[model samples]
Target: MSLLDFLRRRGSAPVARERLQVLLAYERANRGYSDLLAVLREEIVAVIARHITIDRDCVAIKMDRGDTVSTLEIDIEIPHKAGALLVGT
Candidate 1:
């Protein structure tokens, strides 16, 4: 089965399980939580930039409390590549 099908079948998995593990690994590597946040933001922007043009100022990332744990939240503002304004007025 495809990855989506696997994920759908594993719908009982707790949210943020993977992200929490990542954050814990970052901490073990002597990286502060804030530092991890910055790295995550940059990586997310880079990944999204590969698919679309994005406004850097409109990019935001943070950790929020999930129903059972903390979850990483990513927000990106992508514009149409063709003649799209770089900034909103």
Candidate 2:
């Protein structure tokens, strides 16, 4: 059976040889993506900082992979201005 057929037949087909080959190639290229994500996260935080008050430590970005697709999720927590104003002098 073809690779695609094999994958369709079984969700996680036991293609260790093929899987390793693909993983090695992906890992080789993913270093750049990882670095880019880190830089992108910092840049995003910087941009958001210019507009609102946020907790940098709460900024989160993650990559999730599924059988057919992958996703990138970004989550940021912004502080409540009203609450802050209430506590201020």
List RMSD in Å for every model shown: 12.7, 7.6
Q: Quick one: how many clashes does candidate 2 have?
A: 0
Model 2, 9-55: lDDT tens digits are: 78654677778887787788786676877898999999988777778
Best by lDDT: 2
lDDT of 1 by residue, 1-89 (tens): 99998988787455568778866775677645557778888888887777667787788887775556878878776666522645433
After superposition, candidate 1 runs with Cα above 4 Å error? 1-33, 80-89
Clashing pairs in 1: none
| Residues forming the 10-long window of minimal summed lDDT in candidate 2 | 80-89
Off by over 4 Å in 2: 1-15, 82-89
Candidate 2 TM-score over all chains jointly: 0.62
TM-score for each predicted model, relative to the true structure? 0.48, 0.62
Query: Number of the top candidate by TM-score?
Result: 2
